[model samples]
Target: MKALDIRVMWFQRALHLWLLVWLLSALPAAEWLWEHPVSPELGDPGIVSGLLHGFGVWMPSGAAVPVAIALLLFAVIGAFKSRPWWIGALTWLFFCALTDRAWLANNGGTWLMRNALFWSIFLRVDPSKEHGPLSLVPIQVLRLQLLLAYAITGLQKLHGTTWTDGTALGIIASDPTYGPSLLPVTPGLCWAVLLFQLTFPLAVWWGPTRIVWLAAGVVFHLGTAFWLGIVDMAFAFLVFYLLWFPEEGVAWMMRSLRITSTANTT
Candidate 1:
């Protein structure tokens, strides 16, 4: 096969593997909720570990992150844009962002902007290279991850008993584990959760409606953090969720990457 074909094959293989991972997660995600169970049972705690557990996604590429970065290095050395190296880098970045969320990485506004930067990065990608084509893979995959997370979160509310009535917020407001611990939310908070929960799935569809609800979502998650006064994790998830937006231009994104990339060119 030609080198380009080989690169395409590699990218396809990586995309397939990522999708398979996502597909396999459904049952396990639901089951894990029962087994590990991060409460609130609806809204994201906004932290990385809490968001990962609640979303049923395993982030924190862990030791795997460096390996992925190494692959990114090798891919760049050899110029293998078609090889899903970008996908690997994104997965790693997602994990790294998750870590930031877990520890309350920065001061209040600082973390918000920090995560927003990551969110913007998530939307951007570089696909122009002679060695390999920049498929729309990254943008699509990032959105898929966000949509999947929203679906699962919505599922939690739909399936849970506490969510059906107003009591879910009340129950969590009392629990601290399910909701924020710093300051408890009011029964009024449940209404906010309910509105967002009802609209979450709709936020994924393509259109102006998506942005509207998505903005509402940011407001909603931020509200949860502020009201409950637990900001970090919640903000990270929202920042991560912003990965769904459209990329302005792949060429610019990649050129920017070239300037910023730490790896050496072969």
Candidate 2:
């Protein structure tokens, strides 16, 4: 029962930040549609658009920009407010936008962001109140979901000759579309990433290694983003790291900040 009194501020802030980044990163796509107009390849939103259209909601050809802007504002306000319902509503709307056939521009990371937002709706937003871990079920579910993603990806990689031989990164680095011109992807680095992903869940469960594993995760994801030119996807992955961030750590950080501020005021 003692462990149930978890504080949610860290998760809230992380969700807010992720939403902001996701919205901001989406701006360029929105801008492109605003300038080019909707077409099958450029702006075919997705399944959500089809469903909505069936219901008589005709999403205009060039509405992506305004929709993204509104979601961006929602995220900005969420950073300072405790309106979980508003966040949830806006997130659902954004998901609908993402599903538009003309807006077929998403990846695994984007899906992760959407699921995280869906779960965050159930998190308590008031920092002053203590909530049960049971009430924080969404956070736990997200952690499991992320771990499963890592495990499944690692297991899948194991079946690949390139990953086993450590030539997988080299292969990716050679890809013309997503490859980095400057950064070199070596066998050692590829193996390190594979091992890290395979062991991440266990490391987090071990307590002492959780912070180290998370730090390493940040480095790995950032490196991937740099090499793949998928910065937004990296941001989405990093946002979930907050789930493992401990309540004690956040409380201590808040106390230290408060003490520093008070000393400066004196």
Candidate 3:
């Protein structure tokens, strides 16, 4: 492939990588899905149950539900195979429950892993191909939800004069709700975060800029984990996006993981 062609491929994969980072959030989302069952009593419950029913899944709370792992495995395999595309899409819906949990409980749900898990499938779905009717419906729904999230947050982020002024990081760090640990270095950290949120989408482009920006992205997520105390919302949560960097990066990760797995087998 020509250099430009290779760049385009990696860029496309980087997009998927971003979504995959969001997909690993399945475990915590499954927990919330069990504890909080949505029904007609909650008002307009048809949407939730209807979607689940459409899939082969029934969501009643269970302590030992392997649903999360099942879905994760299913998505990984589907990324390899081509099962009902909607299956991957439905996985995102299940995690939406946890995002709701975060909003309802007022801590972005204390489990940002849902974002990783949902995006895992999000980045993988090939919309141009057919996956049958049920698959398409849920896929569309998932896309809408993702768009809404970004649009809403982007607007809210802009609404704050501090964010617009390029100091949103300070706000997040100083705010007890998000990143109190950075309160000491709020000014510098705030500038870094503001720039990150603003520039993240652009990192999808190619060249040295992408790598330097992506490495910065990892550091940025790590800072969030340290300063905000959000559970598992760190560089590790987002490493999947780096799969687009180079085959070597992905290979290194897989090889290391294999080594660790082999060691554990002893």
Q: Pick the candidate with the highest lDDT.
A: 2
Ranked by TM-score from best down, the candidates are 2, 3, 1
* Model 3 clash tally, residue pairs: 18
Q: How accurate locally is residue 167 in candidate 2, as Cα lDDT from 0 to 100?
A: 90
Q: What local lDDT score does residue 17 receive in model 1, on the 0 to 100 scale?
A: 38
Report the C-alpha lDDT of model 1 over 1-266, residue by residue, as the tens digit.
22222323333333333323322332244323222333334345456545433224444324333433443343343233333446544543533333333333234433333333333333323334433233434445544555555667767777877666667766656775655545455656666676666666665565576667777788877876776655544554564443433222222343565533222221
Encode model 3's per-residue lDDT on 5-111: one tens digit a residue: 22222333433333344446534564444444332122344765455332233554352245445545554654444445366566556544433433443244223
Predict model 1's lDDT versus the native. 0.45
Regarding TM-score, does 1 or 2 come out ahead?
2
Model 3: residues >4 Å from true position, as ranges? 1-33, 36-42, 47-49, 52-155, 164-171, 178-188, 232-240, 246-266
Clashes, model 1: 5
- Candidate 2 Cα deviation (angstroms), residue 159: 2.3
Local distance difference test scores for all models: 0.45, 0.66, 0.46
How does each model score on TM-score?
0.43, 0.79, 0.51
